[model samples]
Target: MTAGILAIDFGGTRTRVGWYSNVLELITREESLSHTEEPINAVIDRIIQLAQKVVPDCEVPSAIGICAPGPQAYTGYIRYAHTLPTWDNIPLAQRISAAFSNAPTFMENDANLAALAEYQFGAAQGADPALYLTVSTGIGGGAIIGGQLFTGWRGLAIEPGHIKFPAKDGKIYSLEALASGTGIGRLAWEKLAASNTPSSLRQIDTVDGKAVGEAAMQGDALALEVITEAGRWLGLGLVAMVHLFNPQVIVIGGSVVNLGELIFAPARQTLAELLIDPLFNHENLLKVAALGDDVCLTGAAIHAQKMLAS
Candidate 1:
C-alpha cells in the first residue's frame, strides 16, 4: 500500500483536511465548519474524522502537517488567536498530534504554508523570492525568500494585515481594516450612509463584500467607488511590501479576487505609480494565485513529506 499524509488547514471560520500520497498528491478531501465559541477539542475531533475518511484503512499516514492561524508554535503555545479565541494559549501542536495517536505533527502559519504551496506548485513556481497575500475575511501575507518560507525568529513576520496606514478618513488603521473583503463591505455601507447618491446597493437590506462586488459588476456607481478606494488602499499596502522584501513575484488570492479587476486594476495601477525602482515594475511580478482553494492544504501535505524525509 502506498504511504499517505494527513494535511490540515485550520481557519477561524472553517477547517479543511486532505489525504495525500507521500509524493504530495491529494487523494481525498473533507471540510468542517469551525467556530470560536466551540471548544478546541471539538475542532480536533472534526479534523480526525476527516483524516480517517481520507486515508486508506491499512495505511496510517507517514506524518501529519498542520497549517493554522498564527502567531503560534514558537514555544508550542498559541499566544492569542484573533480568529479562534478559544485557541488562545492552547498547546496546539501537542493537542493536534495527540488526536492522531501521536503521529508526528509539523506546524506552520497558514499564510506561510500558502506561500510555500504557491512557490512549489502554483503561481510563484520558478521564483526564488515570492510574496503571497490572501485578501478574504482578512488580509494575511507570507514571504518565500531563497526558496524557503520566511518566518522571523518568532514566526510573526509577514503579517501584512496588521500594517497600520492612514486612510482617506484621516485615521490610521490596519491594512485589513481598509482593504479586506470585510473592509470593502464596511466602506460601502459607511459611504452609502453618508451620501444620498442613488444606487442599486441601497436597495439591498445588507451590503456585504459579495454584495458590493455583485453591485459593482452590474455597473452601480456607488459600489464601484467603494471598490476603487479599497483597491487603492490595498495597493498602498503592497507598496510597503514591495519596498521591504523586493520579492520576485507577489501572488494575491482569496474571495476578494473573484471580484476581478474591480479591485485589482486600481491596485495594480497604484502599485506601478508608487514603485520607484523600474526593475520592480515587471508585468509578471504581481499575479493571481494559481492553486485557488487548495494552496494551503497542498502546503501542509508538502510539509508532512518534508518531515518524513527529515
Candidate 2:
C-alpha cells in the first residue's frame, strides 16, 4: 500500500493541510484561517482538528512536514517568525510529533520548502543547482544544490532579502527594505508625495506595492519610474546572488511577480548590465517559477516523504 503523508503550509493568513500519497497525489486537503496572534498550542490544535476532519479514519500519517515563516532553528524548532507573533522560540516539530504520538515530523522555513517544491517538481526540476526567490510582502530565498536543500552552517543561510544595497542617498539598506512589495510601495509613496507629478496613485487613500504596479501598468509616469528604480535594486541583489552561488538557474515567484515582464524585463536588463562576467549573463538562467502558490504544500509533502524514507 502506498504510504500517506501529511503536509502543512502554515502562513500568517492561511493554514493549508494536505494528505498526499507519496509527494504528488493529493488525497485530501483542508484550509483554515491562521490565528497567528494566538499561542502556538492553539494553532497546533487547530491544525490537528483540520487534519482529523479531512482524514477521519485513516491510520496516522507516516510523517508530517510543516512550512513556517522564519528565523527558524536548524533542528526544526521555530525561533521566531515575523508573521506569527505567538510562535517565538516554539519547539514546533516536537509539539507536532507529540500530537501524533511521536510520529516523525519535519519543519523548514516556508521559502526553503517552496524552493524544494520547485527543485523537485516544478521549475528547477532538472537543474542541479538552482535558486528560488519569492518576492512578495518580503523577499525570501532558498537554494537547491545537487538536488538537496542547501542549508549552510546554521540552516539560516539563504536569506537573500537581508543583503545590503547602497541607496542613491548613500544610505545602505536591506534589499527587502527597498525591493520587496511593501518596500516598493513605501518608495512610491515617498517619491509621489515629494513630487508634483499628477498620478492616479494619489487617488488611493493607502499606497501599496500592488497599487504602484497597477498604476505603472496604467501609464502613471511616477509609478513606472519608481518600479524601474525598484527593478534596478532587485537586479543588483540578484547579481550579488549570482556571483556568490553561481547557480545553474534562478526561479522567481510570489505575488509581486504577477506584475509579470513589466518587473522581470527591467530586472533582467539590469542584471545583464551589472553581471560583467560573460558566463553569468545568460538570459535562460533566470526565469519565473512555474509553480504558483502551491509550491510550499508540494514542498512540505516532499520533505515529509524524504523524512519517512530516511
Candidate 2 lDDT over 1-310, as tens digits, reads 6557888888888889888886468888889998877766788789777766655375677888888888564377776676665566778778777776677888888999999999988888898689999999999999998878988887887898999977777998999888889999989988987889999998989889989999989989998888888888888899999989888899989888888777887788888888869797685888788877678988898988886788
Where model 1 places Cα greater than 4 Å from the true spot, the runs are: 73-77
**Can you list the residue pairs that collide in candidate 1?**
none
Question: lDDT (0-100) at residue 216 of candidate 1?
Answer: 91
What lDDT score is found at residue 93 in candidate 1?
69
Model 1: per-residue Cα lDDT over 14-121, one tens digit each:
788898877787879988776656667776677667667777766666788888886774344665667766566777667777766788888878888899999999
- Model 1 local distance difference test score: 0.84
lDDT of 2 at 207: 87
Question: How well does candidate 1 match the true structure, expressed as C-alpha RMSD?
Answer: 1.7
**CA lDDT of each candidate?**
0.84, 0.83
Poorly placed runs, candidate 2 (over 4 Å)? none
Please provide TM-scores, in order, for all candidate models, with all chains considered together: 0.95, 0.95
Q: Candidate 2, which ten residues in sequence have the lowest lDDT sum?
A: 50-59
